[model samples]
Target chain A: MRIRRNLAGWMVIALVLVTMPALSAQSGKVTILGTWGGHELAAFEKVLEPFEAATGIDVQFTGTRDLPAVLTTRVAAGNPPDMAALPNPGQMLELAAGGHLVDLSQILDMDQLREDFAPVWLEMGSYDGKLVAIVLSADLKSLVWYNPKEFAARGYQVPTTWDELLALTEQIARDGHTAWSIGLESGAASGWPGTDWIEDIMLRTAGPEVYDQWVNHDIPWTHPAVRRAFEIFGEIARNPRYVYGGTTAVLSTNFGDAVNPLFTDPPRAFLHRQASFITSFITENNPGVVAGEDYDFFPLPAIDPQWGVPALGAADLIGVFRDTPETRALIRYLVTPGAQAIWVSELGKLSANRRVTPNAYPDELTRKMAQTLVEAEVFRFDGSDLMPPAVGSGAFWEGVLMYVGGEDLDTVLEFIEAAADDAYTSGAATD
Target chain B: MEREGASPLVHLVIILTCLVWILPTLGLLVSSVRPAHDVAATGWWTVLRNPFDLTQYTLQNYREVLGAAGMGRAFVNSLIITIPATLLTIGIAAFAAFAFAWFQFPGRDALFLVVVGLLVVPLQMTLIPILRLYSRLGLAGTFVGIWLAHVGYGLPFAIYLLRNFFGSLPADLFESAFIDGASPLTAFFRLALPLSVPALASLGIFQFLWVWNDLLVGLIYLGGSPSVAPLTVRLSTLVGSYGQSWHLLTAAAFVSMAVPMAVFFALQRYFVRGILAGAVKG
Candidate 1:
């Protein structure tokens, strides 16, 4: 019954995504499938408008997460959309390996792309040493959101180190206020925010190299570093004084709603850790609150301090399924600063291309986020998103939820380890 | 009326069952008017906390849904797909059922058994092959494509239902019609067709609703072409993969549900009689 409340919210989202069709009415057409909706889709249309005008190529955008499934079905039926923007690299690699994707290297100028994109950004879209997709948009996940005006009222200082963050939590509790407003409930994606926490903690506590090892399952889940990451999350998540409505609320509150308390009058809670997308949700839900005045974010503090600051985030990579002169022209335009400037300026999204000037981002905070991505010595993609779905989206998500639900840390890790072993060993990741 | 002593208990049970069935629909009706955030933050029951406050209500959701482009066309498209599919399935299946029921022929029982066996074949297993066939025949994304799919899928049960109903008719009626200088066709038209209205009505209702509500068949065959997609295909786009904005879904769902609810209520009596007809004999 409790879960149904959250499900109702998601059901509305699933039901309401039906929108306008971007049908191409002219010659030189490219059909692209993606999963964007509402504001995001509006912004994307703005991005494509300029490209369409410049190239005189009509781009038809069909939005759905059903891309892979639909693509598979259509391919079996001997039909597929021209290109698709995948949520992760796994599917891109799947299509590429299956020979369903056109190799970008053969048509586009790779040296130019390599010069424009960060090595990691380039790496995200590559499979079997060949570039299969191009990373277009990225969002930073390393920030912990809080209201700066409230921080000023409380005489709190931003913490750059892990010890100071812990002390601030104690100080907030001592002031008779909750320090954190943690909510992981997101319907089919309920435990994802919790997964982000574990990933961030892993990045901070065990360093990026070990984080990679853990994500790839080269190291077992029972390893000390992974366990320590989960335990460190427990310090805030498991503690009743640190969190707003206790552990049950963490399980019950929608992650979008998690930061709502931080915006209330006098502020009910002081902190929420979420990706860049949470900013829109914050402003959309509580219209009166100003970003820098009512809320601002600082990167999650360094755990070991010896490890340079880390940012965990995800990106959308586009892969072409049908090759044509028009499709090739679209791909070439996408990797440029001019094309991305239209999207970044409109949507407050950061570009993976280094060629895009910092000023292209809409706001001061976004400019700073793009700067953080540029300066960070260690950055990792969301760990769970990188692993096979059976473990990453599946067991790892459930593992974190179970741990937050007061299950034994060892038992939860062991459960995740069991899934990871099967998922990795069976080569589901490759598939 | 039959159980006089248990009437109070029966009434109590009936009331409870009605409450169970009606509450979700009531909640949906209440939610359709409330602001998206208000609906998300508080349960629909919270409106009853005051039950009198009208301050938070709005018709914004409905205005947006009805005013959207192609919604009117989508409603028209659903009718075009559904009406033909329903009528064709019923017309074709009625003949096949009549033949299986009245005529004595070679492998007649085996043929009836074969039709019965078709019910076990899942719709999903046949989709790809059917789509391939449709594509080769140049029928995909056409109204005929979806109509043919719905009819094919709706047939096994339709034939089974009509055959059972047809077999239950009296042997003497057909014999008397035959003795009176009636050909088999004349006998079928005169005796069988008019008497099977209840059965036909029920089958019509079932096939109509099934075809109307289907999303997979419409999406696959029609392939997002505006010229032929039904309401579900249009309504599905209201949601992106992330389920970003869902308030529209509640309104769209109610909009689509209205026609079917009307159809059901109009045809309910016949449907009940048809389902009950010859059920006891089996």
Candidate 2:
């Protein structure tokens, strides 16, 4: 009778233990909000799956392009997601300042991250002396794409300096082919390409300190350095002879579609300037053209050759909104090289983690770009993203369109300066 | 008689107007079938050049959209939302509308004046207030939260359309029923509802479409849980705002439109007859 009682007790213990995991799983789920979707979303899930399997932590991802607006609604309703992968450093800073973000230093060995990331990347992730975000993926924007086959067949070589680059562009024009394909149209954000041109030129001509000061509006929009940057952009953008269709086509064509002419028979245009992400569009449009063999990229040719290589890049920063064990674990896993290698290999993305080697990249061009990003002497976040939206997205974007449409440079500069004055002064009051 | 003399011109005008409306939808349909690369690289009109080349098209987009993991649950959520919201609006609007048409009471005109004025209060103005109220009442993220929201927003125009129809019905019908020992409740259930089907039917179509196509309200209240999201939300997440996969968007657009199109066709007789009934009375 004692043995029978023991058997029944054993059965009861088994019943409780078997059902325990199922019950606990319900409450342990962590929700993440991000803007990456489609193939990018698929890549992210693939990268994070191992962590989920290892820890039995269910991670739910929700994506939306308008992440900031959605996050505002959620936070106001007191139902913020457990973590959010923010698209820019400026937005991360805003959330950090609002007391909505949890400090990563409390839960993470942030000093260890110093070994993984470039110092500038880490600085961008911090707000008010607190590490609030860890960057996941980066896109390098200082690339100029060209048809290497056309270059080789014509006995041409890649330019190594700004002057040589200009001469090559003129030579291409002289050959009765268009030298550059430039498009600024992007629907509501129609003038962003113009901003990139100015930012890139500013980095080359004025150096990084002035570039930083200009972005912060520590220097005025009308300053000579800023004007010179605009003038250099105009030399290419405003000239009808250098551009593929005309100066007018620069304002009308969609940025992605601008590269299509480069792959046409005899190659309609020989050169295009865009971020590295344009590879997907180029390969998709021209199915037979192989990367590195048909098309290639080089960093924007140096102007002064003195201050160092200033590469403009963008990264998605993930911040913890709640100090939960699940979120902390996920953040830790994300920053590790093993997890980052999966993302880099799948999406052709760059990792801020130093241990994620260039060999993790999908192709030779991407591998080289990754190495360049890591080894660059100077790097800066996308300038428009760093400024307030009122000036950055509103007046600055609009000013580019006006300038491209033949509005005088001073008028556009004055227009943007007025907006910056209001945005910065109003921001100071809020602080 | 004059319309007969002008008939050919009228037909021409109608044909041109209809062409303007139908062309975009035709383009979307053509785009939905083209390959993802072609949709991005070329115009849909390019199909006209090589109409016989079936290799240029595929059903892959539709397969992806329908086979998406969340679609089945989202389809159910949409039904759960739209059906109840439509029924509730018709039921509540019918009662409020009937009372305004039949009853004699103090400040009746003022109350109705307020109800009509409420029609001008946009849905954007109400979303935040209702969200706060829903959270306080523990209705946030539940099916009932969005259902109540649609009903509230849908009521004003619903009552207005319905009240006018009920008011236009001959007064002698309700009176005869009342005199024959029918209570106002009895008259409402037996007499008023039967004759109001055409009006209610059209109103049902309107309410269903409004609730089905909604993204903002669903996103705000339902919290993107696959268990509670609708098709519009699911499809929207397939394409981010910064970049679009056009072939998927076009296919998803058709998939979401399919149900409303079916509902419209099914209820089209009542839709046309109701408009005629209202128009003939005037």
- Top DockQ: which candidate number? 1
Which 10-residue span in candidate 2 chain A carries the lowest summed lDDT? Answer: A16-25
Among these predictions, the greatest TM-score belongs to 2
Q: Compared with the true structure, what per-residue lDDT tens digits does model 1 show for residues A195-283?
A: 99999989888888888888778788888999998999999999999999999999999887888888777788998999888877777
Model 2 lDDT tens row, B1-282: 465676787889999999999999999999999877787667899999998999988998899889887789789778877877887788789999999989999998999999999999988776666777777886777777787899999999899888888887888888888889999987887888889888888998999999999988888787676666778877877774356464688999999999999999999889976654444553
After superposition, candidate 1 runs with Cα above 4 Å error: A1-28, A53-57, A425-431, B1-6, B106-122, B132-139, B181-190, B225-227
DockQ of 2: 0.21
lDDT of each structure?
Answer: 0.82, 0.83
DockQ of predictions, in order shown: 0.24, 0.21
